[model samples]
Target: MSRTSHITRTTGETGVDVQVGLDGSERTVEVATGVGFFDHMLHQLGKHGGFDLRINVKGDLHIDSHHTMEDTAIALGQAFAEALGDRRGVVRFADASVPLDEVLARSVVDLSGRPYMVHDEPVELAPMIGTDYPTSMTRHILESFAYHARICLHVSVLRAANPGQKPDAHHVVEAQFKSLARALKYATRIEGEDIPSTKGVL
Candidate 1:
């Protein structure tokens, strides 16, 4: 069976469309969220996770990027959950550590059918990575995604080496996204013919 899902979500704040294929190797990605940096991050997520993903969002950008970012995350999470189906024969837990220059990020994921998040950034970042991507919203995005996807996720910045200063926001955030992608990719892999849980369900 093909592990694929398409989702369209519309609210007073935004309209989002997302499509995802879990067992994909094409690394195909098309994302336009009205925020350049966010689009870049989503591309990284799909590429590194070995998933084909497409996202198109129209949001109330006249105010800020909050609605666009959060709504996109939610829709993407919904797509993932739908695609996963019964979560059978899957490696349900995984962790990854990724580094980019001076930033080292670690992410752990559990497809537990419950929403939970624990996020920590040891290094301070600039207020913004680009013209519109706020550093603060990074955690919120992860939280929103985990919540809607019903996954337990933990992400932490383990090390930031700049000899005495904070790492660049872009590098830090990129490393986190890459780590998350890798972790999720491993967790979602089809490993066996049964659900990977003691309770016989996820």
Candidate 2:
């Protein structure tokens, strides 16, 4: 099975095209979503997930980050769905435990056609340190991605993990990507496994 996919989408809000190869050794990330921080996060996602990604996007950022972020999720999710056609013979469930100094965050995923997200952490993030607005943007991005991609996601941060230590926002956000990468790695694995569904098709 070749883990390569190419997808293009042009919506009223955004236009995007992306190519991803899951089994590739060399990764190249090209993203132009008018959001530098978001682009960096996506690049981290690609690099850590062991996938090659190439992306081009044009969106109406003059209004807000909504269109760019949402459309990016939609495009990327569609690509992932197209790539994993039928979802056969693959590990369909995965979880990861990631820590960023004081923040011990975790994520779990189920590649099911049910879209859901459980953000079990407080929405308090330091200002001007990272993506400007981590709580809203990251949550929105992950939720939109899950819904569009038809996957289940759960993200949680351990309370009192490390108080009084203001961890870098970049590190905090990067931990999330690393967790995503680890979960995706397990979820996309071919384990000689069944379809992991009772409908006989997925």
Candidate 3:
């Protein structure tokens, strides 16, 4: 089956459109919100999620990344929710553990139509490959994704003993995205036409 979705949103704050293909070849992301770091993070999300994602954001980024980032998450979440249709025989639950060298990260997701996030702090992680802004933006992105998509998400990083180890923010953030990708990949898979739950809805 062809699994794809297109979504559009416009408000006084922003104008956004996104197209995503779940069962497509690799990924191609085009995001220019003028937030350089946020763009990189979204690109990583698309690449590792194995989804062909194209996002266009026309927003007042001169203000900040808030509008761009939150709207992007909302659009993408709407796309996924639309593409999934009725939840239908999908796994609905998925988890992944990813390690970027010493920085290990884990993400767990449930397509349960309940929005929630549980994160473990420090909340401080060295960037995996980009600037600090996107690193901080990750938390907000995850929160928006879960809320708009009506999913439950939990993320945590185990405190490793190597306090002196050079913490690479880029690597840590990349690991987080990779973990999310794997978790989402499994969660969105289509198995049959059942509701994935005892109740006939998600």
Q: What is candidate 2's local distance difference test score?
A: 0.76
TM-score of candidate 2 versus the correct structure, residues matched by position: 0.88
- Prediction 1 global C-alpha lDDT: 0.93
Indicate which candidate wins on TM-score: 1
Please report the candidate that would top lDDT against the real structure. Answer: 1
Which tens-of-lDDT digit does each residue in 1-202 have in candidate 2?
Answer: 7877888889888888888777655667677777888888888778777778888898887777778878788878877777777788879899988876666677899988778888765545655334434446677788877787688899776532466755565666667867887788788777875788997766
Please provide TM-scores, in order, for all candidate models, with all chains considered together.
Answer: 0.97, 0.88, 0.88
Query: How far is 149's C-alpha from truth in model 1 (Å)?
Result: 0.9
lDDT per residue, candidate 3, 28-145, as tens digits? Answer: 7677766677777778777777888888889876676678878888998888888777677788999999887777889999999878988753444553334326466678888888
lDDT of each: 0.93, 0.76, 0.78
How do the candidates rank by lDDT, highest first? 1, 3, 2
Candidate 1 lDDT by residue in tens digits, 1-202: 8999999999999999999999885668999999999999999999999999989999999999999999999999999999999899989999999999888999999999999999999536889977899999999999999999899999999886678886788888999999999999999999988988889988
lDDT, residue 140, candidate 1: 94
